[model samples]
Target: MSYQVLARKWRPRKFAELVGQEHVVRALTNALDSGRMHHAYLFTGTRGVGKTTIARIFAKSLNCERGESADPCGECSVCTAVDAGRFVDLLEIDAASNTGVDDVREVIENAQYAPARGRFKVYLVDEVHMLSKPAFNALLKTLEEPPPHVKFLLATTDPQKLPVTVLSRCLRFNLKRLLPDQIAGQMRHILGAEHIEYEDAAIGELARAADGSLRDGLSLLDQAIAYGGGSLKADDVRAMLGSVERGQVFGVLDALAAGDGQALMAESTRIASFSPDFGSVLDDLAAALHRIQLIQLVPGYRPENHDGDDSALISLAERLAPEDVQLYYQIATTGRRDLSFAPDARTGFDMALLRMLAFRPSDGATPAASGGQRSAPSPQRSAPATPSAPAAAPVQQARPAPVPSHATPALATHAPAPAATPRVADAGGMPDWEALIQRADLRGPLGQLAQNSALRGREGNTLVLALQPTHMHLAVEPMVSQIADRLSEVMGEQIRLRFIGDSQGAAHTPAARAASARSAAQSAAEASIEGDPLVQALKREFGARVVPQSIKPFES
Candidate 1:
């Protein structure tokens, strides 16, 4: 005896045997039980999701000899013949092959006659959408007003192609694709009934490969059973499906968390040897990252349900910051779509990895300082040397402790600290207006303006700021309020800021250069602290680290 594949062997003999799609089943069962069947019924869904299969079952139920019911008795001659595809009253037509108007006209002519062997004459049209428009028009009248004994069951994967006129005459039921868990459960039942030995993971792999189609899943299972020679394993299924193992994904993620570029490259090389699809690898990476995000957000996520090595996955998830995991997921998802245009899969994969590394927080290196100079306070002065002639005359000095920036508000009206004193010009006047503006701290769009603008001294209630022709055109029109606020804060006055358009500029003086140098050093030191390797390692390993908002540096 030739063995039937599981798909055909376990095909739903009755509505009870159908795995998913309860809605369609219920509607048909009610129609059959109540004797309220429509003249024409349309079953629509993706291939292998049971559009055709349900049509057959519904046809059988309508003509079953034991009386119409949700659970038709298959032993009756009518049900048995329909199941065997030999019933005279139940005709199954392949609309794709016989779709001309003449074919449909022949069916219309036949519909006027009585049933040959059953209570109802059922015409099951598979892929009904393939019928020509003219064929549909020819069949419309018979479809709308068929004899009481005639039933039309139409099945199509693409119902949109069918004319709306034809659609209005039929009762439509949409069948949905099965979920993975549902498919897996059904496979377990079928395999157990067949006494075939199989691993759960292998079954899961088949379910995922099927992508929500039960028939496709069964077909894959049949192939897997043959490949395994009766017993199936997860590794065998992975190889058969050309799916990347979950462990490799974890390894890549672990390397990323550890910031080990060499380890990442080595893993890529190992994966390349298998000639695995890099696009699939990226997809798996995205899945793994998604799982990690769930773990981070859910508080107690477990990876035990996953079929591959999950220890590394859990470890990496625990180590990497949540934000980094989200970023990696984004990059990998984009890389998957861009893989086809790359020179090769490996190049695409490597470029994606580089992007991830580039955005990753620096381990210890400080980013380069940007923006302009800031004024620094002068050094404290010692009392003038005693005029006394005695050798080793004592020199008195006023040494002031460094005051924190936050402390300045408490003494806003007091004389400035000695170290906070602004630079004085020769012959005892404020520093040159142009030089003063050059020494002010500014950043972002404001910094660009300062580099090209001059200062026209303080007025009674306003500090007049001047810009070069190019700078004025660029900065004078907008951003006036922002410039005013920054200037007022720096000069410690209630002076309003106004920009004057001019082309002249001034170079930084010796004092301004010194101040700028000092400011750059301070910024570099702060950046170094923020990006320290030790701090980054702490963040990765424990999933927590000090951020600017969460912690402040201690004052010495």
Candidate 2:
């Protein structure tokens, strides 16, 4: 006997054998058990996502020897015949090959007659969208009003091309692309039943490479098993697929976080040795950054089990700043898009990593400096303009670090006051939080969030903030962490944040205070304008009147 491929050998025989499609299965089960099944049905989805398979199973259920049921006894003659694809009543059609009016007309003509071997005749047309307009039109009336003995099951990868007249007459069930985990689980089940040993990581790599298609995954598995001499190994599978390990991607990030240029280049060179697709590598990096961001911004967010990537992701999430994570994510994705334009794949990848290091948020800007002393700039090898200074002369630091070329907004942040001389509270009260926010020069949405929140007081390591109930929704993950980080730097202590709704309905926030001050200034300016002696003289001499709307305030 010849060997059968895993995909064909392990094809789902019934609804229970299917995974990741409970919604469609439930609907079909109800329709069958309650005997309210529709005459014409359409199953639409991407390739290898069980569109035709579901249709076939539904056909088997309808004509099972045990009677009409969601579950059919496979031993019975009718069910066995359907499973064997030799059932006289179950007619499987491939519209891709026979897409003509004549073929559809033949089906329409045959659908009028009763089933030859079962209670109902099933017409399973795969890729129904391939049918020509004339064919679709010819079959419409029969499809919409097929005889009670006939059932039409249409499957297609593309349903948009189908005529709406035909679509409106059938019950449509859209199948979903299988997730990587779902694909991996099914792979594990098949490998166990086949008594084949496989590394969990290899299964994960195959599942990801499948790109949401179980059939594609199984095909890859077969190739991988043969490639590894009948055993699955992570390194072997990666070599076969030419994919970089997730650790190497994480290593690049770890280097980026530590601000180690040499280490970053070393990791890049190591990855380049594999001669893998640099674009896919950058995609993996971007995906890792996305997960890190979710961990950082989403409270109580659980990480997905992708062959033990959770712990490393969590570690990186804590090591890197939220702003830096977002910046890296953007650069990674755009870098992948612009890879073709670069001189070479490796160079493009190296530049992307180097960019992450170059435009770093805290290259020289620490949360708090000691003794108000900036880190001395590295010695320049270039000759000075005058060429009079000695090489041993101190490299004086007089200014903030020069902004990196092509730096993004995320890289610009407040350089907090020295930790040696932290800002202290006055009169046992909050240290004029509004003034502190201004002095620190917080920017962007984080600044606005701080301005809108009034400091209530502190309890232990946490600070209570009074915010309007309406604006409380703005106090989400990123904003909360950013504000806390900035404040802790200025206060010289780690502070957790807690927000409470301002029930008093009073304007106590910095924004409200600033608005009140502006209003007062405007009123004073308007009064001064109204009482001007020159204006009064002009009005009297020309019989003119001051325009109330034109009494502007000199606000700066």
Candidate 3:
């Protein structure tokens, strides 16, 4: 006689009707069928995940007039009344409202009596965690050992607040949140049954917006149906949810992969026209990047229709390096975090996109001058500073040639030499391992690996190095190959390298020698400061203490 909301109209009446909680359903089904029922049962989960729904269904199963079974017959008066929320024997209490000890005592007082009409007098308490400590204590005795005709069904979103004493007495069943696919499938089923016209993408948007709550999803569906004039379309749903269109998001990513700043900005302008939530747009970008990474790493993996154009993603994957994708994803997530702190949403998002382009790795080339001379600084290496420049310029200038930031120490050590450069050997003959490593271009992990390694010996073209056990993780295949290549290049001959892990093998590596030198210099500096006559006079006259940390060794 009255209009019913989808949540109410499609409420699950039987255990078989429940979704995404097969584990809990199976346990309850087996227990009920075996007639090995616990007097007290507790169901815990987030809201709209069917905790209260399962409790009501369990109550119906206990009191169904056809029989006390897992599947209750809807035709029976007891099942009908329970479903209608008017069953006298099934007392459904909102513990959120009746949370006092006196209210719990009243329920306890009523539990002493037999069932009014059904086989078992069921007491279903929703949000039971809302009950006070005294009320929970009051529920303990009755909950533990209720009358043979009584059944207690307790539901709560938060079970951590429940006392262990009460929890131990009850059989607890935890309901899990439904996944997006599960929610979407359920919506498709419902829409089909209702004879509603809908786009699958529209359903996907609603499902994602639900954030793992099916009831929330259904409520959103009800709102969507109304908003879309009884028909669901992707654009309408996207607009309603303030979600970015899949095409728009992928377009931004495609532009990013191409390193086209103009195209990316154009796409940003298009995305802005939708008045979409920029944070959500950034989230979509991050998610798409993650999928691209997965696709790249696992070639066998397939993308779904909801993930946007597969061909485009594959193209982007091939165009962009894995490291670049990772960097972009990191920047996007970081920007999303700082979006609120920025002046505006668009500014934050634009900056994040610009950062992605700015940090994109260049191919180590400089645009040639009109006369065909390459005067611009090459992307491969930093230019040497002029002697006339200020003091600060030399610090950056004198640093090692630029290499991929993500390059391992081994890679840094063996960076590619200029094509026109001629092979050079050590001034005299084969230098010692320490001297070779010092001349090696090795940077991060590669440098550390070399500095920690000692050349054991050489056999034919093969070089044997002892690697410390602590740094054995750095002795991977790429690092080993790079070291060998770099060594061969510098020695003006091909060479093979091998590493043996030894705990006490290398204590005199270049890194160790450098550390020893720094320590000696620091000690000398401290002694020099302590012995200074001006320092002694200040300490004696004014009791001015020398700050040990302030002493500098002036390392060469």
Better of 1 and 3 by lDDT: 3
- TM-score of every model versus the real structure: 0.65, 0.63, 0.64
Error of 3 at 456 (Å): 43
370-412 per-residue lDDT for model 1 (tens digits): 3211121112211222212222311122212223332121111
Candidate 2, residues 1-556, lDDT tens digits: the string is: 8878888788888999997788999999999999998988888888898866686688789988788898877778887777677888888878888876586657656888889988999888889888766666656878767789888888888889888987898998888899999999999999999999989999988998898999999999999999999999999999998888886798887676666677779889899999898998998899899998887677667678777667677666655666668768877986898899999988899888877766533333321222322222123211112111222312224212323432232212222333544355777856767766765567889888888888888798788888889888999998799888887887788978898888463268878977876665555445444433344446756887867666555433
Better of 1 and 2 by lDDT: 2
Local accuracy by lDDT, each model: 0.68, 0.76, 0.75
**lDDT (10s digit) by residue, model 3, range 62-105:** 88988888999987888888888888988887888886657676
- The residue pairs that clash in candidate 3, if any, are 409-445, 409-446, 410-446, 413-442
Query: Deviation in angstroms for 368 in model 3?
Result: 28
Off by over 4 Å in 3: 97-105, 355-556
Clashing pairs in 2: none
Ranking by lDDT: 2, 3, 1
